[model samples]
Target: MDLALKKQILQKAQDWFVESIAQNHIKNTEKLIKPTEFKINPFTAVYLANFLTGNSNPESIAKALVYPRVLGTSITTSFGTNIQKFTSEVLSAFGSTTSGIDIEFIDQLDGFKKYCQMKSGPETINKDDVETIAKHFSGVLNLAKTNSLRIAHSDMIVGVLYGDSGDLNAHYKRITSEYHFPVYDLSPELVPFS
Candidate 1:
């Protein structure tokens, strides 16, 4: 990435992270929810039981604080997902095609145009999601193929926003096994998947 673009991305990231956390906190606590009103089991409660210790009162207070915005206000929402998606907007500022790919940028080293499907992290996907991602990447490749655009697989990527090589889950392994391109990790390299 160029310096100006990098700076812009950093600023965007800061805005996404800081502002969204504040927003999530606001949305979650929009009403004064008491501990008594907090629902213990969400429909998938049986599955989530393993993670819970049956410690209610104190823990329920924590749960009640976030019950209003359960899915919308997680770590994934605050950090990488929006930021990665935000790159599409940033890339549009350049004369780049913002289609099929979440991020498209000219490689600073090789001067080749690199394509990416930005993911929050390695843990972001499931078995079905792996196939969906392959289809997404395939759509990009086949689109290029039909137009006679010589886009190399080496230039295509599943960019994970954080974590190291070790943090990569089975879902990521499954992607690499099939696609055989980059599953870039931002912590060690430059990708996000979870």
Candidate 2:
């Protein structure tokens, strides 16, 4: 990947983290928590909805919500779990129902199948692929889904920032090594705070 492209993607990922934290804080406020309706960026909404509703088929939803920089490529299973947990925490903080927030990959695939079938697209997902992806992410997803209710809702900002930082560090290391470039520290100056 071009250095500029990589930097841009990294920045976008960071921005999401900041936004997630902000949203988390807003949800935590007692006044905001009781509101029945709210708005989120369309992309965030998709992930939030999936986590809250536990939609199994996320391909279409993913397609709709995935920031282009993170699309198509395989993400470590841990990232998936983090996202599920993050979504659940955010919803819970806002006093939204989380009955469907469990991150069962099989269920997500089932939903993806239904979505793909309805959209007049080739069925690009297969059981093997789902299993492979799920295997990669199962640990994180399982932990997040199972322990979601136990997480302190007040930690949303810290949790999201920590998760995003880890992922960005990993991505930076991967790209630097892949391109044989000297790894530069991701100084705060290089990334936007918001």
Candidate 3:
């Protein structure tokens, strides 16, 4: 990602968090134990809608407001779940929506399939976790094969969505090499915050 875009995304995310907190505080001033009854402020609706569609137009905001349930859900503390949803939305732009395994898409032209596991960034992992992940994927693949599913041209892909002080790029490299899977660095254009 370019320095300018990164800064913009960070600023947008921070702004959204700050605004959301303020809105929640104001809404909770009445000491209502059940918060879901109150609708989220309009700004939050626009923020979420923009995050999903990358458009801040009034029509988009109005359309986004139609889904009050999504607006009611608070952002995760670490933003991990939000980033995952953002990545899933991005994949859906390419006509994919199977997120049981992070992302699974079928190429319409060639009948090829791609399976992906997504993470917000790199984190420390022990040997046990690695083995468990491998075993889990093995089971999934085996089940697919047993069910006579189309496994042709299927590639196991790992996508890292962002990085902070940690060397997520290096971690992705290590994971790809160790697992013999391809790594896609989506940090450049995939801005979950914006």
How many clashes in each structure? 14, 6, 0
lDDT per residue for candidate 3 within 1-194, as digits (tens), equals: 46986687666656654555445544544343343655757778779779868987876765565444333433223355555555444334132344335666553345576666666565633456455555556666777789998553235555566554345445455554576555555553433221
Q: Which 10-residue window in model 2 sums to the lowest lDDT?
A: 113-122
lDDT on C-alpha atoms for all candidate structures: 0.62, 0.33, 0.53
Residue 30 alpha-carbon offset, candidate 1, angstroms: 3.0
lDDT of 2 by residue, 1-194 (tens): 46876686567556655666445444443233222424436666666557755662655444334433232222322244345444334322222222222321111212220000000011222334333333333443455569773332211111122222334333233322432222211222222112
TM-score of 1: 0.64
TM-score of each: 0.64, 0.20, 0.46
Question: Stretches of candidate 3 above 4 Å error?
Answer: 1-76, 91-100, 106-111, 124-127, 152-154, 163-166, 169-171, 187-194
Candidate 3 contains a number of clashing pairs equal to 0
Give the worst 10-residue stretch by lDDT in candidate 1.
87-96
In candidate 1, residue 80 scores what lDDT? Answer: 52
RMSD of each predicted structure: 5.6, 22.4, 14.2
lDDT digits (tens) for residues 1-194 of candidate 1: 56776787777667755666557656655553564545555544433332354544555535444543464445445555455545554333132364646667676557788787666765876888778777877877888899999888777777676666787888888888876767876432244343
Higher-scoring candidate on lDDT, 1 or 3 = 1
The numbered model that scores best in lDDT is: 1
